[model samples]
Target: MAAENRAFVGSIVVAGAILVAGSPFLMGFLQKWESGKARVLVVYADPLAGGLPTVCNGLTRHVTSTPIIVGERWTDEQCDAEERSAVVAVQKRLAPCFKRPPSQMVFDMATSHAWNLGPAATCGSGAMTAWNRGQWTLGCQRIARGDDGTLVWSYTCKTVGGQRQCTFVQGLANRRADEAQTCGEVL
Candidate 1:
């Protein structure tokens, strides 16, 4: 009886391990099967209208052309070039701050906040922190709702045209009168 119990437990463990190992492959196969049932739709420019076709030949699914659009289908090379240009622009904007040997934690936190909010948000009231060592830290923040039904304090930042900037949302509203003011002042 003891030997039979041990064999049953071992078989159950083996079966559980096999099921776990196969789950990812099973899920992928199921997704593929479901996708196979989807219908294919074609879209093309009206030939009588002349010029290049509004839709590209390789599109695998539905297409619409209610709005006027231009530009040829992007090739991988063009896409890579565009991506490289964007990275270069970001690196250029970040160069000055990077030279100060900024902490990775600080940079990441600031960048993440800037990515979410507009660049002016990084400088705002909630996101700004003053360290005891005389350093200023900026990033996301938490705030309470005011009588106006708005959160008055929040840390936020933004990147625009490859330039990074941050500010408190409320402070920005108050300071908008000063046209010459810019977030670049802090960096």
Candidate 2:
């Protein structure tokens, strides 16, 4: 009995020592946002917004104890967490729909688009079909293709107070350009 007790105590000490040795790296990892490097994709997905029922990548489910007000705000940390969750969820949702493996950047780009649209829209999209066929550049074009069925950045213009105003659609032209180039695609 005494021998067994000693062995058990020795095992505990070894285990404790290992934990002590690993604590610094473990703590650093714990302090990091859970998404790791992919969190950058989430940040890119969630645009800065100053409104409640806020749209982050077009996913709007943030709710607090009380009703979310117009000025209900989120810290960078909070927003990161939320966006990371959305990216992960949508990624999982769309994962099985991919016909072929994608590079990490391409997958991140897909996650960004899926966030802006819904998972259903993304998964069932022609973009998904094209990507599944390993037609990456074509898929990317479909992903960024505007409502006019063209790969062009479009904006809505309105006449307010008899003055014409055009709102660039989230600077989407830049996003499309970035994604296309990353995928070695041109439109």
Candidate 3:
């Protein structure tokens, strides 16, 4: 009975060690799977009238808590600073669950463009305009066409932005570029 108890304790210790060591990888795997399925988990760090968006798949998910009042105003510096801070905070929170560091994440900025054009729309035009200036950064698998006309995947990250915001840009390179550019111009 004594020997059996010792063996059980040893097994439990080994299992605990394994769980601790494997936690990061497990979190990364779960995050990748959730992101792949186009589900974004949004975290809001500010209590003011500001927020940002993170892209899941090629779609944008807003992180705001309330409806944006049209005709409101903010300085360009404020907008930029607020946006940068929000994005960095979100990335930091997600970093632990990523296989690599947050710097290596490939976020889709195009999704931010889409959001500004719709839900996060601004009514004013100026340096401190009432714009929804949310930025995005993440690591993602790039999709490209192969010789057989099938999709090929590669891992990469990119910086995408406009006058007021940015987000992770996912999809084929040429197509994403065109769409992002067009959206930026409109914003």
How high is each candidate's TM-score?
0.27, 0.52, 0.27
**Per-residue CA lDDT of candidate 3, range 1-187, in tens?**
1222112111111211211221222223322432443233342222111333333211223433233233334343333333333333333332233232111112122122222232222111110021112221111111122335433321133345634432323433444343333334322
What are the per-model numbers of colliding residue pairs?
20, 0, 15
Q: Residue-wise lDDT of candidate 1 within 100-149, one digit each (tens)?
A: 33333333333323322333443342433321122422222221223344
For the record, the alpha-carbon RMSD of candidate 2 to the native fold, in angstroms, is 14.3
- For model 2, what is the C-alpha lDDT against the true structure? 0.47
Model 3 segments more than 4 A misplaced: 1-61, 64-67, 102-187
Off by over 4 Å in 2: 1-52, 55-59, 62-68, 146-149, 152-170, 185-187
lDDT of 2 by residue, 50-169 (tens): 232442223355321223333445444554445445444555665666767665445555655555445677788766778788787777776667446665433445679999986667
Q: In angstroms, how far off is 30's CA in candidate 1?
A: 29
Model 2 Cα shift for residue 86 (angstroms):
2.0
Best by TM-score: 2
